[model samples]
Every structure is written in structure tokens, then in C-alpha cells.
Target: MSLRDRLKETRAKASDGFRGGKLMSSIFRPGSPFRKGYVDSPRNRSYVVMNNVLYHLHPVKVKRHGVRLSYTLCLGGLSFFLFIVLTITGIWLMFYFRPTELAYVDIQNLQTTIAFGSLVRNMHRWGAHLMVLVVFLHMSRVFYHGAYKAPREFNWVIGVILLLLTLLLSFTGYLLPWDQLAIWAVTVGGNMAGYVPVVGAQVKFGLFAGLEATTATLLRFYVLHVLFFPFIIVIFMAVHFWRVRKDGGISGPL
Candidate 1:
């Protein structure tokens, strides 16, 4: 065959092979359209909502009042957003943080020597504070609206756990700098835990790994701050969102 005809024949064969492939067949089944091809249409929209991991958390319909900014103030959403910001900034800060006696010097160097280090550190710090405040406000909003009744009672418990986790996350992170402020603050906090009736002393000992804030205490707090509590928060946050939908979207007028 001539070169042009030969090229056409090869192209036709390749096209046929692709059409017969199982991978392509599985992706674009005979009856189903391409996943992206479905948009705006009612069926496709429903499919998207049901199939998508994130979208599945939301109900098909939400109460008008439930979404009103004046009613909800969007505190829960803002808290989650600030959490994302803190996570991103925290990861960036981790590159420069040492979590040891040198941790304070490391932070100082991070602010002075590293590019944009001060900005990232400050964002993480402020984001953490904002998250705690927003989460507290969210709980208050839910409470005042009487959304914690009946079916939502369990979810309210989940929110309370999330609130505690938020506080714990902030507290654990506070000790990472290993400065005099961190040391004394943690020491005072540990002492307060010592006021708990039976387990107080044990809690205090576990907190500092001794009577004082030692290297072990720093490492323990670092692990909980960077790894443990964040993991638990993510899991509980998922449950919290899912329960919101399960309990009939955001609480609103009966």
C-alpha cells in the first residue's frame, strides 16, 4: 500500500483495538455515558450527588433557614476552613521546627532566616486560635437554636467531642515551641490536671512524664499535636458532617 493508505489502515486498527479494550469498555459502558459528560441534568446531578464522596455528605435538599447566614453564622464551616489553613501552615512549619530545647531557637531562625517562614508560622498560630473560637461559637449557635434535641442529640455529643479535640489540639501545639512561656504554661496546665480527683496525679505525671517539663514531655506533646489529635479530629469531623445529613440536614424550623 502507499504510505498514506498504510497510515490510514494502522489508524483504523488502533481505533478498533481501543474500542475492544476492556478498560475503555468498563469506563464507558454500553448504556452509561462518560462520567464528566453528565452535568446539570437531573439524573446526572442525582448520580453525582450519590457517587461523590464529598457531595454524598449533603442532602438533596436543605432548609432555607438552615443555610441563612444570620441563623447559622457559618461558624462550623469557618472552623473547618481555618482547620485546613492550620493544617497546611502546620505542615510547612514542621520543616523548620525541632520540638526540642533548640525548638525556640529554630522558631526564631525560621522567622528571621527562612523565606515566608514568619508568615506561615503566624497563619498557623492565628488559624488555630480562630478555629477554637469559631468551633465554640458553632456549638453555641447549635445550642441556642435548640438543634441538639431528639435525633441530633448524638450528633451534639459528637460536636462536644470535637470541641474537646479542638482544645486538646491547641494545647498540645502550645508546647512545641519549648520556650519559657511554653514550659511554664504547660507546667501550670499540668498542675491544673493534678486537681482531678483520683487520676489527677497520674494525669499530671503522664502529661510531663515527670514533675517537670522535660525532653520526654516535649516529644510526647509533639507527637500528639502533629499526629495523634489531628488524626482523631479528621475522623470525628467526618462523622460530625455525616451525622448532620443523617439527622435531617441542619436543624431548622419544624
Candidate 2:
């Protein structure tokens, strides 16, 4: 057997012999020194993973210098980091902004009133665009790497759903400014939804909450942008992260 396999066997045997409450304590305690630096420690094992069945998801020993640049650059982590940046900047902008009839003028005043508000807004806007582009590229990388095979297929589907949700989030947020571009963009988007054959009109009405782009439409988009999609995206992201572990730690090229 390999040295690492033998070592894991020895550790398992040793851990299995611990008696009393001490056994369970050591098994469950993440900070237990006995478990630290050991590969088979319960805290370090894949037992907690809920998706798929692949257990060799983590390296027994990861080399610090072996990580590939393409994986780091094109993986979804960069997109996530950009999303975080946008979230922080969006929150900051919210302090001096409102999402109503004067939203556009308020945005204009923010550019002039709040210190660095214009920079913050620009960062938020550009970061959002970059995030969308990065997410699409990340999915492409995953696909090209054959990372979505077997146990990872479900996670791949989830990733696709997350991508769609991310696009929806960006679209909804576009309307909160109440600008001409925002209005027409949403109007065109709603009209597209309205072209859903027999249910097109109903779909459009549901999205706008009326026959026209009234206060209800703005309020609906505002709530969706600020609340609903964020919560759903965060949940799916959590699932995605967990699935990464379950799918054998981001599949390598065949």
C-alpha cells in the first residue's frame, strides 16, 4: 500500500480505539490538536458533504505552488469576489440614494454630493458587467475541462441555473435608476416576456403588475433587485460550493 494509505489506516485505527465521551469529542471537534494536520481526521474528512458520492474530493497534501493560473483566473471564485465588491459598493451607494421618481436626479446629485459617490457608482456598474462576463467564462472553462462529468453533472445544472439568475438580477437592477435607458430596457424586456405565445400577455402583466410601467412595476423591480434574487443566489451559491467538494474538488483535465 502507499505510504499515505498506510498512514491513513494507522490513524483510523488509533482514532477508533479512543473510548468514553473522548472519542466522539475528538471526532467532532474541529480544533482538536489530535486531529490537526491529519488527513483522515473526521473534521477533515468528506463525511459532511451532502451531494454526490465522490469521497476523494480533497488532496491529502496540496502543494502550494502547483495551482494552475487558468483555474484561478477562470474559476467562479473571481466572479464571486466581484459580486462581493458590487454588493459593498451598492450598499454604500444606498445610503445617499433612493429608488423612486427622483432616483435618477438623486443619482445625479450623488455624483455631486457624496464624496467619491461617482467613483463608487462607477465601480459598482463596471464590477457588475465584469462579474457577468467572468461568470460566463468560468462556466465555459468548467465545461471545457470536463469538470461537469458524472458526480458533478447535477452541480453543473445548478451552475447554469445560477447563471440565469445572475443575469436576471442584473436586468432587474438596471431598472431601479428610473432613467430613460432603465425604462426602455425594462419595457423591451417585458415585451419580450409578453411574446410567450398564449401566456405572453399574462407574463408581461405579472412582471409589471399592471398594463403599464406604473409605480408597481418600479416597486416590483426594486424589491426583486434588492432582496429576492440576492437571497436565492446566495442559497444556490452555498449549494454550489458544497457540490464542489462532493464532485472531487474541481475536476482536472482528463
Candidate 3:
């Protein structure tokens, strides 16, 4: 065949292959693993939500009043967002931190010498405080709106547990810096734990692992901060969200 005729045949084959692929893709529904389609219709949108791991957390149908910004205020969502921010920044900060006497020096170097280290540390610190505040406010909002009534009562209890977990996460992270401020603050907090009736002293002893904040205390707090408490918090948070769906989505007017 002539070179021009050969080139023409090759182009035709390529075009045919492309058309065949397109036709195969068109056969599957939108959001199929093979091809994602535009969500132009209600059914397609529902399919998208149902198919997505994250969006499936939401109910297929929502009440008109349940979505009002003024009523819900999105506090619960913002609290969860801040927790995610803390988790990211905390993981980054963990790379440079040590649970020993060098921890303070490492933090100082992280803030002054490392690139964007200070930003990440500050974000984790502030995000921890903000998560506590937002979770508390979310609980208050739920209580004031009487959203805790009926089937949601257990979810409300779950929310309270989450709030406590938020506080514990912050408290455990507080000792990681190993500075004078962290030491004294944790000392005071531990003393409060000592005020409990029977297990008070035992709790304090377990917290410090000694009479004072030593290497043992630091390591214990580090393990809890990095591993134990976060795992628990995530598990409970998942349960809390699932219960929100089971209890009929976000609370609304009666």
C-alpha cells in the first residue's frame, strides 16, 4: 500500500478504538467504577450519594427544616473538622518530638528552625482548643433545641462521651511539650484527679507513674496521646455518626 494509504488506515483504526471505548463507557451508570457521570438528575445524585463512602453517611431524604443553618449552626461538623485538622498537624508534629528531656529543645527547634513546623504545631494546639469548645457548644445546641428527646437520647449520650474524649485528647497532648508550662499545668490537673474519693491517689500515681513528672510519665502520656485515646475517639465518633443516621438524620422541629 502507499504510505498515505497506510497512514489513513492507522488513523481509522485509532478512531474506531476510541469510539468503541466510549461506547463501552456509556453503557455503565454514572459513578460506576469504570466511569463517573454528571449528576444532572435527582436519581443520579442519589446514586452518587449512595455509592460514595462518605456521603452515604447522610440519609437519602432530609427534612426541609433539618438543614437550616441558623438552627443547627453546623457546630458538630466544625468540631469534627477541627479534630481532623488536629490529627493532621499532630501527626506532622510527632515526627520532630521526643518524650524525653530533649522534647522541649526539639519543640523550640521545630518552631524556630524547621520549615512550616511552627505553623503545624500552632494549628494542632489551637485546633485542639477549638475542637473542645465546638463540641461543647454543639452539645449545648442539641440540648437547647430538645433534639436529645426520644430516639436521639442515646445519641446525645454518645455526644457527651465524644465531648469528654475531646477534652481528654487535649489534656493528653498538653504534656507532650515537656516545658515548665506543660509540667505545671499537668501537675495541677493531676492533683484534681487525685481529688476523687477512692481511686484518686491511684489515678494520680498512674498518671505520673511516679511522684513527679519523669521519663515514665512522659512516655505514658505520649503513648496515650499518640495511640490509645485517638483510636478510642475515632471508634466512638464513627458510632456517633452512625447513630445520627439511625436516629433519623439531624434533629429538626417537631
Candidate 4:
């Protein structure tokens, strides 16, 4: 057997007979990162990174270039942070919102009556816009950095799916106010969807819930904005992060 394999066997035998036997071996497993500076060697370093709970999201022993501040310009991290902010602010806005025709009145009350309501609403609105930009920029950074090559190709597709979901979220929320502006904007958007070849009519109908936008459309968009889209985006985000770690962490600098 290889030296490393033999070493593993010896460690197992030793652990099987130690004071706490298997319990100690389980917690302190060979090369447990909790034992800091344990032997400073390649094998130990790899084991440390592999066994550390905190490394689940990002393996610390990454390439030298991946550590540079300018390498990614923090776009990916910022995009994720903005998503979290949007989620928090979105939830806060939800408590005061209604998807019916009274939605506009509810919005006005939020802005004029509820304490910090205007602030939170504005934060949610602007945060959504910023998240769209940030996610796009993050994708652009990945593309230019060649991080989308090879095994990361699937992640690139996931990122694109996320960006599209972000756009849909933003569009759906735009109608939550139930104002004339929202109506006109969505009408124009739906009309555009109606030109999409074979599924055009169905797409537009599905979007606005009838021949045109209505109270039903408002409720439909509301559910999609507040529930469906968010749930779908989150699932994609999890897989994207998992692929990042599995594909040997982030790619090195170009």
C-alpha cells in the first residue's frame, strides 16, 4: 500500500486503542484542522481543508491568485450580499402589502403612515435594482476572468438562470404598487411577450392572467414575486455555490 494509505491504517489502529478509542478518532479525525499548525505539510494541509466544517462554502487552500483582492473585485460576494439585503427588505415590505386593487392605497399608507415604512420600501426597491446590476456584473467578471471554462461551465449556466430570475423578480414586484405606471409598464412588457413566435399568446396570457392586466394579474405577479421566484432562485444559488467548491474553488487570475 502507499505510504499515505499505510499511515491512515496505523492511525486507525492507534485510535482504536486510544483513551476514548473511536470517539476521539471521530472528533479529532486524522489531520483535524482543530489541531492548528499540525505538521505543516501538504498532506496535512489537504486534510485540514477537507475536514474543516467552515470550508464547506469555500475551501481555504485555494490557488495563490484566487486570494488577491482585485482578482474578482468582490463582485460575486457583493452580489450575494445584495441578494440577502433584498430578501430582508422584501419580507419587511410584505407585511404591509396587498395584491388587490387596494394595493396602491397600501403602498401610500406604507410611505406616509408606517414608521420607517418609506425607508424600508425604498431600500427594497433600490436594493432590487442594485442586485440586478451586481449579479450581471458578477457574471461579466466570471466570463472575462475565464472562470466559466471547463468544469465551471455548468455554473455559468446557473448564473445566467439566476440573472434571468432576478429580472423576473424585479418586473413582478413593479406591479405590486398597482399604479397607472405599473399597469402601463406591464402592458407594454406583455405585448412584447406576445411577439415570441408560437408560445407568444400563451406567454402573454400567462403573464397578465387574461387578455390584459387586471386585479387577478396583480395577485398572480405578487405570488410569483414574493414566493415562487425567490424559492426557485435560492435553489439555483445553492447549486452554484456547491459547484464552485467542487470545481476546485474559484478559478485563478487570468
- Model 4 per-residue lDDT tens digits across residues 1-254: 89999999998766546634566566775676434235778898777767766554667577888778888888888888888898898889889988998899999999999999999999988988898898898988888888899988998999999999999999998888999999999999889999999999999999989999999999999999999999999999999889998888879656
Model 1: CA > 4 A from native? 1-48
**What C-alpha lDDT do the candidate models reach, one value each?**
0.85, 0.77, 0.85, 0.86
Candidate 2 residue-wise lDDT, 1-254, digit = tens: 99999999998777655522465555544433344233555555433332213322344443343266756564587887887898899888878767677788888988898889889989988888788888999898888878788889999999999899889988988887788898899998988998899998999999998987766788898788878998899999889888887666757645
lDDT, candidate 3, 103-159, per-residue tens: 989999999999999889888898888888899899989999999998999988888
- Candidate ordering by TM-score (highest first): 3, 1, 4, 2
Q: Which of the two, 3 or 4, has more lDDT?
A: 4
Q: Write the per-residue lDDT of candidate 1 for residues 1-254, one digit (tens) a residue.
A: 79999999999788667765677666653323343233466666566566555566667567888777799888988989899999999999999988787888999999999999999988988889889999999999899989999899999999999999999999989888788898888888889999999998898999888888997899899999999999999999999998887887888774
Q: Which one is best on lDDT?
A: 4
What lDDT is obtained when candidate 4 is compared to the true structure? 0.86
Q: Count of backbone clashes for each model?
A: 0, 0, 0, 0
In terms of TM-score, which candidate is strongest? 3
Q: What are the models' TM-scores?
A: 0.81, 0.74, 0.86, 0.78
Q: CA shift at 80, candidate 4, in angstroms?
A: 1.3
**Model 3: residues >4 Å from true position, as ranges?**
1-29, 32-39
Q: What TM-score would candidate 3 get against the native?
A: 0.86
